[model samples]
Target: MTVTGEDSVIDVDPLEPPLCAPLRRDLGWAQVQRMSQSAGHRDDPVLRQIRATAAVRRGTRMTKVLSAAQVSGHLGGWLPYGFCYRACDIAHLHDPQELALLGTDGAVSAEVAYALRWRAVDPLDYEVPGGPAQPGLATLQAHNRVGAMILGTGFTPSTDDLVPEFVTAGFADLPMPANAQLIAYVPGGEEVILYTYQPEQHGWLRLAGPRWRGLLDTLPGVTPDREYVPCTTPGSAKLVGQIRDREYEAVADPPEEFRVRALTRAARYPVSTLSRRAEQALWRGVPCWVLQRDDAWARLRLVRPDNDALAATGARCYERGVYESWAPVGELADHHIADIPYVL
Candidate 1:
């Protein structure tokens, strides 16, 4: 088969290759660019341009497209071809067992997006337009069903998952105590602490003692690292420093080059929503700053330390931030800077 732009097709290429590779090759460029312009991906540039072009070719207004897997990480029965599930898969999410399949680390993260259907189970679990139904949501606090979930008889991790050992290590000894439904709650400002000395790294970073709670209302301006004043400094300062430290070896304020890339990309989107996302992405690496080069709409940067991250995020900054485009990253990186005074 031939893509619209490329005339040649490789022969004997199909010995039933991996699911994503074939689908990726066959997809129209528009979808690929949609992926780049999508969440903070930094995917292949060829893919980004093709997707971007395809998006425009369809119409002046472009809708982003992503592979099923790109939409989320691997799930029990999902593929680029079909049987897809979003990161949210609430049925899996509600149960700690199912939540274990989330990311490569299988650690608890806010990343998962429960399927819209799962909202029926607990409308309060997710944020809904006009602010999720807050009425009956209070009921989730005490009922035994609060954390209830359904799983396969012996749902063990498979090769399809990133964290095969997660289930065995995490809830294996979480004090079932007759398989209690709720894990008990700790009040706000309670200085809650949880720990383990397991010889595995599940999170992107590790900390020794109690870390600052990023949530303001819960701790009321308490910083994670008490080495520095908490409420006095903006959390954005710490976050920007953290991302830079991770993406790059050093931890300093973002440079002008970073901010310029952010501003240029944010220009591609509507400021009402994505500006904040653009600010946050500044440190990730440069974004797909679309500029007219020889009359062709192309990404300003060829490759970046992190690629395709900002565009899709930038796009999602619109109204609800569900479906993506490289918009949100651009928005956060570009907009949030104003709020972060120390970085200035």
Candidate 2:
């Protein structure tokens, strides 16, 4: 399906009130630090405010800036499933170059940066940190940041100036939402949209024009000529369009940020091959990407081979530079994709 210039734009009025007021009013870095040190109960006013401010309605656009490595992983068919913030919260950051630095910790990179965007499906999945429910977790994160600084790693400590961040509850991963976009921020402040997910076709539709097509070379397993690369991975969230009082899934006209002129010239080419990458899963409380699996056993590779992961799963390197072990299907926790959390 071809979408032209004005035809594809979804008009979102800037004045429209968001589902919930911005949390900045109720929570700040100061409040975060205070709550992190307090032994207050869950019903504390500050805690309640944090929870209320974090509430999101379905269809709200969420974004997560992607590192260069993450961009390659997505091109290799890794589903997005980690920390993301509501797009409306960061709307004030108009400069594409400045916005690109959100995920990179202000480190200017030689390579291009990217972002993953998807609409919200369920509010329960997102959680505001430093809330009463997870005070200890927040404290630990603060301590870790300080430790990093002491170790001369140049980690920025949380302060009153930073914005509040959220995480997927229990760090669980969600299925990619339909219409999720992979956008690239080039060096010269140009926001080049590379691909948009097509739910019905179950693949990413390459929308980068000739000028931007060169960026595809940086992504593994992706090329400019392959207009559609089939991905049958399941998605739980969807972009909803409303006409009058009726609602429909995967029918929403994309926002102006998502509609590029290249979309008009794009064609839905046939996909002759399918990706055979194994889905991500959790085993013995450790995250892993499946290498091979069957009804009873799964040959899994650890997502993070840190000491904690090794101790939790007893995973060992059977071959040089490869850490993996066989885990029974019954022992696996959740058969879901995992993304690296962007913690504050």
Candidate 3:
């Protein structure tokens, strides 16, 4: 495994909506913090822990993720394109290079995946000139995921839920580690994935082995929006694709600024400032309720009898009259909170 480091860059910051990071019970916060600073404080980088897999506790505010330092070329790091290394946004991190390695997904998806990120082992990071491979890069590469993300239905016009249709359509079942599982995302009305989530996310749905070729050409889940290409990794092993779903994309190619990384989920967590406007459309048809509000960038919690988007996703936040997580107003939207709440 080769390790690489990136140069610090300055651009319009795309604030990854804050995620309530998950920690191992045995792994204390202090230890994780120390490890993150020394290594990649977490996966990807400080502003974008892309490789995170965070899960909210069954009934608690706490979320947990298993993250370690990594620095190898990303394989399928992005969900829709070939691999491209991420230049992290590290304004708060002490080391611009060493990020807090947290989980399988990073900060961007932290907002998209509804606080829970999918954790996968990416065994392709190579050490670059300034970026030396971190301690666990090799172990991560050797870890194989065992699930397949066959094309499925979301809100598309015609929902394709039949798995057997794939074989009949000449797409054979690809091999995956017994532990692997497929994830689905609908990025546009015409395609399932096109514009990636973030920089590292350009490598769409990472896969390994020779069978990857057949799968890329034939996956039924893929919309006509993808542009298939051969792998560009160290050994040139896997086949990847670049998404053509630019019609629905909110940002530009090789973006100069950070735009929406996660478009599916709304910013539900409370913050010091409220930015929910009718235009941001943070929620998919779900309207957010103001539990309480003060000045800008103040704390807002989900009070009782608010909304059902949480229940719809089978998730929640507030419990026993306490707010679990919160963020700043500007981070979630471009406007300010206009409501004056009467709390019970």
**Local accuracy of candidate 3 as per-residue lDDT tens digits, 1-344:** 01112542334223221222334466454543444333233233421231221111111111111111111112222121111112122112222112212222232221111111221112121111112222211122111211111111100011211001001000011111111122112222111122112222233333323433332333334432344322243221111212243212122112122133233435211122211111111222332222323354423322211224333322232211111223344444333333221111
Model 2, 1-344: lDDT tens per residue?
Answer: 01123334445434222322123555554555555334443346544444354345556677777766666566555554544567765555445555554562233454676788787555555655444322333332222221111111111123321233454543334545557888887766667778887655557888888888888887765666788877643432223332343433323222321111122325222222211123677899887766567799987866444456666777764321124789998898889643332111
- Candidates 1 and 2 compared: the better one by TM-score is 2
Instruction: Please report the candidate that would top lDDT against the real structure.
Output: 2
Residue 152's lDDT within candidate 3 is 16
Clashes of 1: 57
Please report, in order, the local distance difference test score of every candidate based on alpha carbons.
0.21, 0.52, 0.22
Sort all candidates by TM-score, best to worst: 2, 3, 1
Q: Which regions in candidate 2 have their CA more than 4 angstroms from the true location?
A: 1-51, 94-101, 104-111, 130-161, 232-292, 295-311, 314-344
Per-residue alpha-carbon lDDT of candidate 1 for residues 29-97, written as tens digits (9 for 90 to 100): 344334433223333544333322211110011011121232222111111110112221111234323
Judge candidate 1 at residue 227 and give its lDDT: 31
- State which candidate, 2 or 3, has the greater lDDT: 2
RMSD (CA, Å), each prediction: 23.3, 11.7, 21.5
